[model samples]
Target: MLVNSYGLNGMGIEAIKLFDKMPRELIFEETYVCVLNACSHSGLVDHARSIFFNIINKTEKIYTTMVDCLSRAFLFEEAQILINNFELHHSPSPTMLMSLLSGARNKKDNHLSEKIYIRIEEKFPKHKNRLVSASILLSNAHASVGDIEKSLNIKNKLYQLGLKKKIGLSFTEINGQIFKFRAHDRSHPRSKDIYAENDKISNELIEHGHQFDSAWITRLLDEDETIASVLSGHSERLAIAWNFVANPNTKQIQITKNLRICGDCHQVTKLIAAIRQCEIIVRDANRIHHFYTNGQCSCQDYF
Candidate 1:
């Protein structure tokens, strides 16, 4: 738990220190995985590699974690090689391929995305659930690069197959009470104030020279929707807006998201932390991000 907490807070070095201090007899497979995850989240790829190679008994989970570390660093060739070597002795794991695909999506590498999707299809044809996730990642990779037609095609195929995507949601706690929000949610009693706060923050962001990037938009904007409008409605943004409405003088905001935070929301959160001179910690599906007051994230832009 300590190692995971350190990783969650982007304190990889501290996590490593604890791992080293642990008694030799006490170290287990999970211990290695935790440390590798810490290194992955904190961008300590070299450290992760060293630790990974030294392990005497490498498990599928360990290889997946190492693959994730390399993938997050955009070392596609190295990651692929690791996956290939793993498959030599063991069957392929969907989790491993998904890690590489996710990294390709983050980099918007269309070619790599297609290649990885093909591999996934060839290996996991019968695995409907994993295929759904792979398709989503592949579609997102295309959408991120303005290939909306391809993205829509993937989505349409999923719909035709009757496979549903998971909905994104964010949760926050204030005054000992937890609140949940979805994209464009208006169910909260203080919905008006929350949106107004978001608008105010959006204007401040613009003043700070933050332009909403349309590349992050995955679909066509409605007549009433601008890039800013759609982005401001993201679940995490709504959660942040609620934080401000619930407490105007808040100095710290923490949120938990059910999905990976999108690129736009990640950028906006960094700017918001700087603009408000507050600390913002978001625990997304992949990892935790600590947004500091200087417009920097704990992940160091790796995410």
Candidate 2:
């Protein structure tokens, strides 16, 4: 009715009003979830907090939803407080805890990260999955602070648990064309063309005072250069290659990946963005990492 009577733009506010008009008994778990979602959509922190508190007497699911909303809003401290105060424990859902850790990492609050790690271990002793998840979080935090050895050790522990890091892949649509690639994938029909273009662009970058660091390049290249050639086959690279072939004059490419991007790929993407003078938006497992020509990334090399 709101959409038909007013417009789609007014539907949300009208829906909230209608929800307000409904008796308290009519509001349930789903209602609380919807309200929290609305708060997320509209950036209504105060309204979200009020509705979140109201649902506290309801269910753990509601608490989880509230925690998710607060975390999405980057209110990690508040989210932590909610979890701490309510003492809500629904095992196996490491999202809230992960969010808290990520928030601390973003803030460079290493002390808090250590404390949270201990708290998580103590509070959820039965959930062994937290070990891997927490380790990954700690690895990320360590990497952000240039503690490479510590980060690699954490990653190694996960690998020891038989949990290998999945390669990141992404596909982008440009001018009605879809391009795709996986890490070290060489199966694409246009593989040769992609390599040729990468070579050309890399040369131009070097000529323009962009020094390719041995550390970054060494990771991509193998003993036979075969492995290095495979790096171009990465999903992001594949998408970029496709974008290059599909669009003749486009300036930007957007790719979304399902996993946390590896260190090597992150470095390469930044260089690619700089050399091409194109905006590359990469949405990874954690957050969006936007690469640009000024040798910078949106995550500030934090992820």
Query: What TM-scores do the predictions have?
Result: 0.76, 0.57
Q: Residue 221 in model 1: shift from native, Å? A: 2.2
Please report, in order, the local distance difference test score of every candidate based on alpha carbons. Answer: 0.90, 0.66
Expressed as tens digits, the lDDT of each residue in 171-239 for candidate 2 is 777777665677656677877777676666556645656543322221223477643454445577667
lDDT of 1 by residue, 137-190 (tens): 888788878888998898899989999777899999999999999999999999
Q: Give the poorly placed runs of model 1, Cα more than 4 Å off.
A: 1-26, 169-180, 186-192, 206-216, 251-263, 270-274, 277-303
Model 1 weakest 10-residue run by lDDT: 1-10
Clashing pairs in 1: none
